[model samples]
Target: MPEFKTEPYITDSHHHLSHQDFSSDIEEVIGRAREAGVEILIEGGGEVALPYYLKNCLSDPYLRNMYFCAGLHPHDAMNFSDSILDKLRSLATHKRFAGVGECGLDYHYDNSPRDVQKRVFRKHIELASELKKPLAIHARKSYRDVFGILEDEGVPEAGVLFHCFSGGDEDLARILEMDGYISIGGVLTFPNAVRTREVISSVPRERLLIETDAPYLAPQNVRGKRNEPSYIRYVADELANLWGLPVEDVYFITTYNARVFFNIDIDHGGDIVYKLGDRLYLNVTNRCTNRCSFCIRNFRDGLGGYYLKLRVEPTPDEVIKAIGIPGEYEEIVFCGYGEPLIRYDLVREVARYIKERGGRVRVNTNGIARLYHGVDAIEYVSNYVDVFSISLNATNGEEYNRICRPLYKGAYKEVLKSIERAKSLNKEVRVSFVESSGADLTGAEDMAEALGVSVR
Candidate 1:
């Protein structure tokens, strides 16, 4: 909103950049990361990146500021021969390399012999200590054994990081006591990810970092699809809500922690968002027609500094550009702190985007589009809008004028006119009431009856 060139980057301290999920074109992976503001992406622990460290693995990977952590996955414990350990240990010496082992016991899948897993995991712990660097760990249903080992073995001087942590507050507090930074993943975005949210809510901002764990544990929208570094916005948003801070603030704290903890540099914190959720809720402008009492947007700014700031109300093309590709959401909600109809053309353009993609569009308005954006607004709705939930604050101009307190002259009549048009153009229209005593319910019902539009 202020026209500041916000840094659009982040550091993913934990991911398998070398897994087959990225084999097709790793360069594109890096490029996409850059586009999404990811400047430095640290591999959780990948043998795939080892070749890049082979002096000729890939051009200047280490010097490029990209990094890798090497270790045997506990699931692959059976493959942990003396030679493999030697190979991983060898890569640990690379300047671009940081930390060790995403390797830990997986009680869920004891694919590797328990004894073998334990032995290999300890070897990685020892490697972290010997190398004097951190150890990136993977603990799944085996926190007891994992934490016991780290506590016994003495966490490496570079310290420890619990990668893609899906643990409880107790585990988090224990890990924090051990001086380990908790890096969270897509699990935090799941509506039912209660545990992840609990961990997020309890942890201090300074102790967290966000990760895609790409090619795996993909965040909600991209579930089953190949996850990438750019989708971190969803994760960041969820964390921001959990901590009651802004997405930018979450990114800043996590990125700062990541940069400091991992000791990698390259501007990891700028416009940090976890994953781009389905509805890219854009507050096209903060200028609302109705002064709703419950509006978080009105009281706060841009949903936790998400840059959802609609300071320079964008044109429809700009809205479409901000919406880019139209596939990001189940529907792009035009609801913001203010009325979207304030920029009618912009709403039309965005609706067109969704219609083209066979996507849906929802416009949360005070039933005054015809008045604000003119007759053209309802015309656009006939074919473009799949669903519209309008605010029917009152039945007549007097009550409507009093409740909504619209600034536009004759605003009450304008809303009634818009509702009439909305009913004609959209098949699915529901006029909502705010469930307040001040509203005229009987009059609202009468109006809904007359307009053939149900009032809620």
Candidate 2:
């Protein structure tokens, strides 16, 4: 088999570190995982033996990044006792204990009576809610029952994860409806797993996560061998192929999802300014009026490697500091996960700073600024912004309404007026259209022509 290249970063969202299979070579296994870019590992501690495993393995600084979830597995539901439940509840408060479970029902094995499994699962759900922590679930052939149980018990506000999800469209719809996350594993690479692949394709990118259920479900390429955290790169590769995104994107996104889901502390410092080639892009805010079908924020936080989901919007001074010596780049552009025009004053202030420092300024907007601000925004922006690249996503008003879903009722007409106004002000205006499936590109181009602007 060809060697699988490691991504820049990856998080094995689910794995079994305490499984007796790796006791002898656990150190080497962890080494291999780190070398392969598995930066974080969430060990599955559903079985009673997990506390012992963690006691033995967690002292090593090298394994410090590992976190574990404690709960009863359906397979162990038959052996469920108050003593075991007490042990799990104690472990739930451990500093490294990230969540509750690997705890749902598994009807395929029938290792435990169906009624027993349901009762044990309810306890786990209640524990998660009481402790305010995420629930990592293990479900197989019991998706419907699991959903019903979760509904009955009321899902924990902290969140729920369907670990190593192997479900169909109906299950996926239900999971999404509950705002639950689906962590996929090596099964994604199986040739016959068509239904799982469809679930993968349909899942919103932000809700998607990757895992390696190590020592279990090794990927198709290494089917018979013992799985390990190092093999998470293979799962990420398959996800990239399924999503038609770059492997690096899959790595970063899954890692971000894991960090957020587990509430793991990592430095996200809010990259306000990012550079691509000669252009510098400033991310001032995440607020936007339109929920466009093709917007990247639906899939991930930011473009390239920068995480643009700002916890707090930056001030003009902060933005200017982020753009220090702006003349270094060919042009400084105001564009980010949000519509830049929403923070009109901030844009003007920062644009003035860049322009004073001999930097060219451009603004990428969704063209509803006028409607958003209830004024002639183009006139104000033209004074400071040298160029305007507006999104004319659809050709006609009806098409615009369907694709952009702007908050304003007559947003499409406002966009057309904004374009004409920008041209009248003699500002360098360029209209861009994203080629979504079924978008009327010809009509969009004709609209741009009518407005006397170039289409990009």
lDDT (C-alpha, whole model) for all candidates: 0.70, 0.83
Candidate 2 per-residue lDDT, tens place, 87-157, comes to 88888777888998889899999999999999999989998999999999999999989999998999899
Window of ten residues with lowest summed lDDT in model 2: 1-10
Kindly list the per-residue Cα lDDT of model 1 for residues 1-456, writing each as its tens digit.
233223335677787767766767777777777787776678777452355334432355534657778888888888777788778777876777767878888888888888888888898888878888788888889888888888788888888888888788788888889878888889888879886787678886667889989878888977878888878777887888887765666675677677667766423222111123335454566666666554554443333224343435655655555555556556667776567776676677778777898777777777665555455565565577766777877667777667666767887776666667777774577788766537666766777778777667
Top candidate by TM-score: 2
- Model 1 scores a TM of 0.56
Tell me the TM-score of model 2.
Answer: 0.72
